[model samples]
Target: MLEAAKAVFITSGVDAPAKEIADLAGVGVGTLYRHFPQRSDLVKAVFQREVDACVAAGPALSANHAPGTALTEWIDRYTEFLATKRGLATALHSGDPALEALPAYFMERVGPTLGALLDAAAASGEIRADVTPRDLLLAVAGLCAPVDHEGAAFSRRMVAFLMDGLRYGAVPPEPRG
Candidate 1:
């Protein structure tokens, strides 16, 4: 049901009807309601699920791919995850108390995962050691959240540029003495 709701939310916005979600899930509205009694409940659950999935990918990606490749692909996957959040943006800012903790949860879980990725990449000398996970996370989030009517392509291109920057001068900065 959460997966169906996520798809529906991505395609139709968070305001999409519960019936649509229920239909996609092949479940009755009653069933959907039984699990997630409120829209906020459903939204929160879907967001948490997506976050978990994204964070979980980091380890598997590091294990399966080269350090640089894993870092790159994980960021791309993170971009897609960010795209999904576009639909939820409105609801998130609607001052819904239930949704208030989502941003914190996102940072708490995603930050550590990204930190692990960065650490591995730095250890392998695949990227600059000076880069911090929090900085990278904020940078990507800022880039992924398009502005001035910009499209996904622009965000993606900018992210690629950022990745290049990370690769450039892949060494720690000189001491500030």
Candidate 2:
């Protein structure tokens, strides 16, 4: 049901009817309500579900690919997750105390996973060692924000450019002539 809620929230915003999520989940509205009890409850569950999925991807990616490739792929995943997260962000900032812990949860869970990846990439000479995971996370979050007249592709290109900049520092400096 959380998956259904996430899909509906991503496409239709958090105010979308509970029936839509129930239908997508192949359950009755009663079932959804019984589990979540309130719209805020549903929203919180969905957000946590998605965040957990994104965090879980880090280890699988690191295991399957080289450090640089894993980092880039993880960034792409983060971009997609962020794109779907704007609606949830609205819910979190809606003056509801229930939603307050989510931001901290996101940072605490994601920061270390990203740091591990960054550490591997830097140690392997695939990116600069000077970059902190927190800084990179904020930069990506800013880049992922939708700008007027620009779209995801533009943000992606900008992020790719940032990746290229990181790679630049990985290159050894030329010896003085």
- Please report the candidate that would top lDDT against the real structure: 1
lDDT by residue for model 1 over 24-129, one digit each (tens)?
Answer: 9999999999999999999999899989999999999999998889999999988888888887888888899999999999989999999999998887778988
How well does candidate 1 score on lDDT at residue 164? 92
RMSD per prediction, one decimal?
Answer: 3.8, 3.3
TM-score to native of every candidate shown: 0.90, 0.91
Error of 2 at 92 (Å): 1.0
> Which residue pairs come into collision in candidate 2?
none
Against the true structure, whose TM-score is highest? 2
Can you write out model 2's per-residue Cα lDDT over 72-140, one digit (the tens) per residue? Answer: 999888888887797687898898988889989999999899999999988788898899988988898
Model 1 clash tally?
0
| Candidate 2 residue 81 C-alpha distance from true site, Å | 1.0
Residue pairs whose backbone atoms clash in candidate 1: none
